[model samples]
Target: MIKNSTKVLVLCALALSLFNCSSDDDNDRGNWIERSVFDGVPRSNVVGFVIDELGYMGTGYDGDDYLVDFWQYNIAGDYWVQKADFPGTERSSATGFALDGLGYLGTGYDGVDELTDFWSYNPGSNSWTQKADFLGGVRQAAIGFGISGTGYIGTGYDGDNDRKDFYKYDPTSDTWSELVGFGGEKRRFGTTFTIGDKVYIGTGVSNGLYKTDFWEFDPSTEVFTSKLDLDEEDDYSITRSNAVGFTVDGLGYIVSGYNGGVLNSTWEYDPGTDEWEDITGLEGYSRQDALAFSTGTRAFVLLGRSGSLYLDDNYELFPQEDYDDED
Candidate 1:
């Protein structure tokens, strides 16, 4: 039988200790913060790119229909503004890359047929102009990356077969030329990111199985080099397709997608050492076919499908910090 005063004092002490522990746990978490929700309808298989200081995302499938409406995001303002609709037919799984301050989007499946029509967007004018068709012909689910002032796109299903051929697009000349094919297996839905002059492409589905082999593309030499395999021996479990990737401060990160099921794991890639290390997964919904865009300082993960649901939320990541979600 303890006195009421003695019991009250013990409870107060316990509360104080818990508060201190909570504060310490928060400090250990990663710098991923939820930003304003995307203004567009919930969607997946979207395309995104950063131009100047702003980011643009559009052209994806919403559960029932293909989407063409485009939206621009102002990072500093934390808001989205709708721009003109994509001039091309409604489509999804399109590939896009930003080069020379302009964004290029092309090659996607449009419900009835795979398409190769290419389009360019100008942020300064908020207008889109059709560009030269992809030399790879009508295809969808390809990968695109920008490096050394040129845009490169390739590899996807062409209604009948998976492809590994690659092409280079010259904005200054408005031309597309064939380049060396990817070194890995023919794949679609792979994740790609460019750091300095090198581009990294990996983790996708081919034939009937998921692929974990990674490749590094050097624009200068126009060659594709294999990196450490994701399935070699280590615990490298960050394998999936329909995922998205972006680079911040020269480091690349791949976020949520589908393997045999919806995936929520996150991974970081180091180009200098050609190594990948697991990071904390996004605290938001686990999804696949999401859109990713990175400015010089920040990276974002947005719109995608989770099972039968479409998501329109956006998450920001500070790669330099540790990720702690338990708190």
Candidate 2:
């Protein structure tokens, strides 16, 4: 009887160990490591674009005033260097993209009015030159991306109304033209990330509701193909405006945004599978309007607001690693 009781106790202990291991595996699939804090003032609605190995970020609101100070981040060195101030008016909620080795920024709110001015950044000379104004009129919180040496900007709010139109830019001629065909809803503050030749756009709020419809835009075909809804799965919670979207290791990720309130949730997208999997969220404070930089291989999120509080902290995500609170 004594030996039988001892054997039963040992089996119970083994079962308990297995249960704990399973729980940990289920809860921890990704990790976030805090990196160097942003050198700029804490701000939100900043715009950024990655060019080669460096990332350019600028133009945001620090809760008090609009900002124009521009900064360049070296991904390999993990440091930031102040660049020339944005020559445009102080603004926030602008959109930017990099193409043909040059960066372009335009369309934002400048405290008193919406702006349609566009400018291009020449990294070689470290200067910005005004380009043709956006043809879509003055808007803020629009989405922008570069594909095949051309830049595209679309969908945002004018002073009074939200928009769903898209336009393309030609750097050689410095011209803007409308590129219609997007069937998605009108939204501002939506997120987009490019994978290969296709760009995925989704999230953001329209009519005070978080948008769930996802779409893929192919520059070659100039078509907007609908993907799975963000809420396709019963467990998927991937709709939020002001989130940051980026690609790392050929996978797309959206992290930290507002949906009724600030959120720290992270969702990973597989282009081949058209599916989203929940990953470890931002280990830091939940935020919205943050900036994300991806060097094709590495990605990082930084500088945003949590409610009324502005933040300058940065974090890098390791999607396949086990979660560890300690960096």
How high is the CA lDDT of each candidate model? 0.86, 0.93
Clashes counted in candidate 2 amount to 0
Can you write out model 2's per-residue Cα lDDT over 1-327, one digit (the tens) per residue? Answer: 999999999999999999999876655788988887756579999999989889999999999999999999987888889999999999999999999899999999999999999999999899999999999999999999999978999999998998999999999999999999999999999999999889999998988999999999999989999999999999999999999999988899999999989999999999999999999989889999999999878889999999989999888888989897657
**What TM-score against the true fold does each predicted structure earn?**
0.89, 0.94
Q: Tens-digit lDDT track for model 1 on 1-327? A: 578888999999999999989876654324577888946579999888998778899988998999899999998899989999999999999999898888999999899899999999998888999999999999999999888889999888888899889999999889999997567898889888888778888988997678878898889988889888877657888789988888888888889989888887888888888777777677688999998879857898988989999998888987668665642
Predicted structure with the largest TM-score when compared to the true one: 2
Which segments of candidate 2 are over 4 A away from where they belong? Answer: 1-27, 38-40
Clashing pairs in 2: none
Model 1 pairs in collision: 29-324, 30-322, 30-323, 30-324
